[model samples]
Target: MVRIVPFAVEQWMDEYETWAKYNIAETCSASISIDDLRSLSDDPSRDPLSTSTKLTYGAIRGSQTLRSHIARLYAPPTGDDSSTTVSAENVLITPGAIQANFLLLYTLIQPGDHVVCHYPTYQQLYSVPESLGADVSLWKTSGEDGWKLDLEELKAMVRPSTKMIIVNNPQNPTGAFISQEVLAGIIDIARQSSIYVLCDEVYRPLFHSLDKTEWPPSLLSLGYDRSIVTGSMSKVFSLAGIRLGWIASLHRSIIEDCAAARDYTTISVSQVDDRIATFALDPLHAGKLLDRNLQLAKRNLGILKGFIDAHRDTCDWVVPRAGTTAFIRFSRDGRPVDDVALCQMLQDSKGVMLVPGRRCFGEEFKGYVRIGYVAETEVLETGLRELGEFLKAEYASVPLI
Candidate 1:
């Protein structure tokens, strides 16, 4: 039996994703039409992919070609760090990053083991460990610190029993990333304690265009033998429909173990889906998609910043440096706003949808909401207006608590 609680964010998305007219809640990559995908088929290089057989379960450890592509994505372009080119043997394909986490936690954690995880992250990073009976310590991120995870606090929390540390970079909801220096420090901490780091780096490639000159750090490179990075085509590729993802590690044992655990559920990703994902990762196509997402995040973020500026007193946000979403607080007289009520009222009155912070960040930050402002430009404009109207009409700043 699955002991984990039902995912509240998914529940909200289920009911409203289709129903909402102005959905600013989605953090999708550049939307594509079916024809747009079909257009990729026109490429002479991808012609052979169409005939890929589907009768077989596909390669057990992911197709060598697909894994090779994934491996290359993490390798440094040149110079001193070039040695980190992950091999196919180190990659394990999963249905999605969510499932990748499941396989890793199920493989590594035992009852009574300690796990330290960054909070306000994708819930499975912490909750799944708890459900597995690991004593979970949350390294909570605060708005006052720009939602950055504090290393000193994490240093205080680790114990001899700690087995794993789950981290999400360009993190969910808050959208803050750890610097290379910070990542190196974490790697040091993990090495000293003999802890494995499971980094959910789904948003790594989605760094905002504002910071294009610099690159996001990779835990696989930073943590040496003890790190595992998992990601899906979902976030940065806008390929949620494909149900494709992978886990990359330097240790072949972790990949082997996750593959063994994968036997219980999702033995292999779709043969056809794997082929398409492989096609999507082709150097040119992949580069094109990267450029598209960078443009979208840069444009939409500016729009979001303007909206935040307009309501500066009523709301505030630490502008995101990467990823499609940011954590925003709606306040009433300088206190946390009732985000649940606000989201409900907006849905009812304006048909708007925003994730309540409690759903992603946990109970301590209920006044905040996760807004994925990377919607179609017109849709986002109206969503912001709707949210503004509702904020003004009801909670116009008379402190309650």
Candidate 2:
């Protein structure tokens, strides 16, 4: 029947994102206004913005200038930009990271292929492969052990038939990441198996500076010949509205294949989006934009931490090392709370939106919820207070299980 169910998380967000008074369910850092892109574009050094961006179907090959801007982000040794960081040849523009991943899965995996993916992932990572008839294995993350990937499981799961391994770094929902050491280990496993590793590196540079984790380079830069990195302006860049993304690969074949497949889908990014994205990625403005977003997220994270601390008897979380969201488990006396019901009630009554763990990590994690720390500071504070009040009135007396 080819039933591809609605992406539960995105569907949930769609239903309530606009309904919420305090929208903490958002994954992007607040939202970027057109003025935000203009601020970056106003840089005197780069050529001025061209208002005459033709409304035609645009270039399937994408803008060379934009590709160059993206290429520079993946400076080589760690990035695949072999000739001076990365060349335009190595990039294939997509509508967003979601589409970038779709292209990779659509083009690379064949029916009956073996695919291993890090779980608690963006649903598409596994779902697309499953729909393609791939035998998929999950590499579970240990929230108790700090939401780290089980590299040992990766070792045990891959077989002679394994075709690819997928990962999301500065992962969605949990915000856990694979460090360079972890990256090296996974790369070695892929190399030994002679399989490609597709890393969803959309959350780069969101690394918590105060914490030990430093901002790491994309897997494309990490010296793996077959490593394919998918990234976008959506995450740390706070530009989901732009819908700009790309795939970076050392292997020319992957880029070519994805570009070819794209012809059947979105065809090309809108010219206006390409121009705005180019400006945002300009060297002088990129750091400032990233800094602005990181500051907003960190401030909200502090508020979230305080909320979590106040509810210590009922909840706990492995603090995220990077990115905007964290997966938190809340229970009533050591027993799992009905996370779906709790989230639904919170949204329906208090107008606070949060994604339930079931949407991200599957049924086994239904006791958890994904909280995003990227809204306006005041909104974040109020949302936490409302949530705290609800918890107090409802589950306060429940014994810690």
Best by lDDT: 2
Tell me the TM-score of each prediction against the true structure.
0.94, 0.93
Off by over 4 Å in 2: 41-49, 76-84, 209-213, 396-401
lDDT of 1 by residue, 197-289 (tens): 989988877877545456656888763798999988888877878788888899888888888888888777888778877877767677777
Give lDDT tens digits, candidate 2, residues 1-401.
45465688888888878889888878888777766666675555554357666588777767898898888888754434443345788999999989999889999998889999998878999988888888999888878788788778889999888999999987888988788788889999899878999999888868864463355667876777888999999987778987999998988888988888888887679888887788788787788888888888777787888888888987899988788888998887568788887888788778888898875569888579898888778888889888888787865543332
Q: Give the Å error, residue 386, model 2.
A: 1.3
Clash pairs of candidate 1?
Answer: none
Off by over 4 Å in 1: 38-54, 394-401
Task: Please provide the root mean square deviation of candidate 1 (C-alpha atoms, Å).
Answer: 2.2
